[model samples]
Target: MGKLVDGIWQQAGYDTDNNEGRFVRWDSSFRDSVETDPDARYPAEPGRYRLYVSLACPWAHRTLIVRALKGLEEAIPVSIVDPYMGEQGWSFSDGRDCIPDPLFGARHLHELYVRAKPDYSGRVTVPVLWDRRHGSIVNNESADLLRMLNRAFDAYANRDLHDLYPAERREQIDAVNARVYDQVNNGVYKAGFASTQAAYDEAVGELFCALDWLETHLKGRDWLVGEQLSEADIRLFTTLIRFDAVYHGHFKCNLRRIKDYARLEAYLERLYAIPQIGSTVNFRHIKQHYYSSHRQINPSGIVPAGPILPFL
Candidate 1:
């Protein structure tokens, strides 16, 4: 949980004390795009982009699911970072199932950020879409990457599936996503990482409120916005999947588990049944990362072995 300062990696803890004991996530720095238009600087092309991700990260996991769903596995390659992000941040491990950066063979993930921008100063996050041809980061924001992967490479995608963000449902999907992102997705972090009781209380209250609303809303519906699954479902699914396993205990967001919500539990099970979606989840990495990485939250670094997810 460190950052890069002027191309140099710094092993430092988060400074929540300054923000009135509230966890404020830093905005993603890279925001470039890979449009499908021929005039675009980053035109859609197979084998032109690479994804750097961490299985433990929900944001990064979004891209992985999108890539698989869109059949971009052969089009765009991926390199996964180690789950336990220590003082130096995400690192590459020399083990099976982990792909090394063939482009630079860098040990640390920050090295790629520095390679992209030597003066870069920010949190080195995952789901970085690197432009192999330009040797620079195309985008580090997960939402942006998800959209890009959805349609940018349609010409080369294995199948043609539109409407992940359909024009007619855009308004509803956007609205649902905004609230879910604030009160649920990011809300869990706010509650878990809150340094003050006031902050934690406010965050946890909001989180459960959103959950209650969702439980009622999804009682008979299959998806969040439209009649079909969209980006909103994908966005919410990542957080809900991890709620009971890690966030409930590690983050102190234990008001009620996702399993406690009948509707949400069924919803989660339905989404988890999706072939590509279920494969993206790595419980071992997810549990190990949170319990072991945040030393301040869990000083003992003792990983728990209970609350087994029945769906998984």
Candidate 2:
């Protein structure tokens, strides 16, 4: 949860003190793209890029889902960080399904950010698109990574891949993504980290309001955008999948469980049934990270074991 300063890892948490108890997520600094054009700084190529991800992170999970759907596992390998974010944020561990950083064998994720830019100062986030050839990060923004992964490696991706962001449905997809990202995907964090009751109430209120809308909107549809699955669904799915397990309790997003919404529950189960999507979720990591990482929220660090998921 800490950030880097002048390329040095700084052990400090979010400063809601200055923001009226509302949590404001910082923008991801690395925004370079990997394209099909060979002349581009980061051209799409098999075995040339890697992903640094945390299975527990919803933002990181988006890239993983896209990579799986595209069948880009072989094209772009991944390194999974430890579930717990301790004094050192997102470190590499030898156990617990954690994959160490193979490129530099760095013990912590911040080191990689420093390697990418020596003077970089920001939060070291996951789902980082790393340029192995260039020895730097191509991008860390999940939204950017999702689009790139969808088309950049088309030549190498699975032929049966879904065009997640089709040209015809882009307007629809973007509209849904904007609301869902702000209200649902990020609302949980906003509510959980809010230091004041007003901030928490505001976030939680908008969160369930959006969920209510989604429940109604998804009643007769199979996906969020158009007829087929799109980036919008993928983005929302990551947050929904974790709602009951982590967000509902850990983040105090407890007004309603996804199961409470019949349509949303069925929708979640339908999406999780996809082998490509289902395989990327790791509840163990998901539960572990949320319960343990936020000491201010859950000082006891006790992970709950009940609320058996209906989808699984």
Best by lDDT: 2
lDDT of each: 0.90, 0.92
Error of 1 at 125 (Å): 0.2
Worst 10 contiguous positions by lDDT, candidate 2: 155-164
- Candidate 2 lDDT over residue span 1-312, tens digit each: 688999988789888889999999999999999999999999999999989999999999999999999888998999999999998899999978889988899999999999989999889998798898889999999999999999989999865777899999999899999999899999999999999999999999999999999999987899998899899999999999999998999889999899899999999999999999999999999999999999999999998887798667
Question: Which residue runs does candidate 2 get wrong by more than 4 Å?
Answer: none
Per-residue lDDT tens digits of candidate 1, residues 192-306?
8899999899999999999999999997799888688899999999999999999999888898999999999999999999888999998888888999998889998989997
Candidate 2 similarity to native, TM-score: 0.99
Write down the RMSD of candidate 1 (Cα, Å): 1.0
True-structure lDDT of candidate 1: 0.90
How far residue 129's Cα lies from its native spot in candidate 2, in Å, is: 1.0
Could you say which candidate leads in TM-score?
2
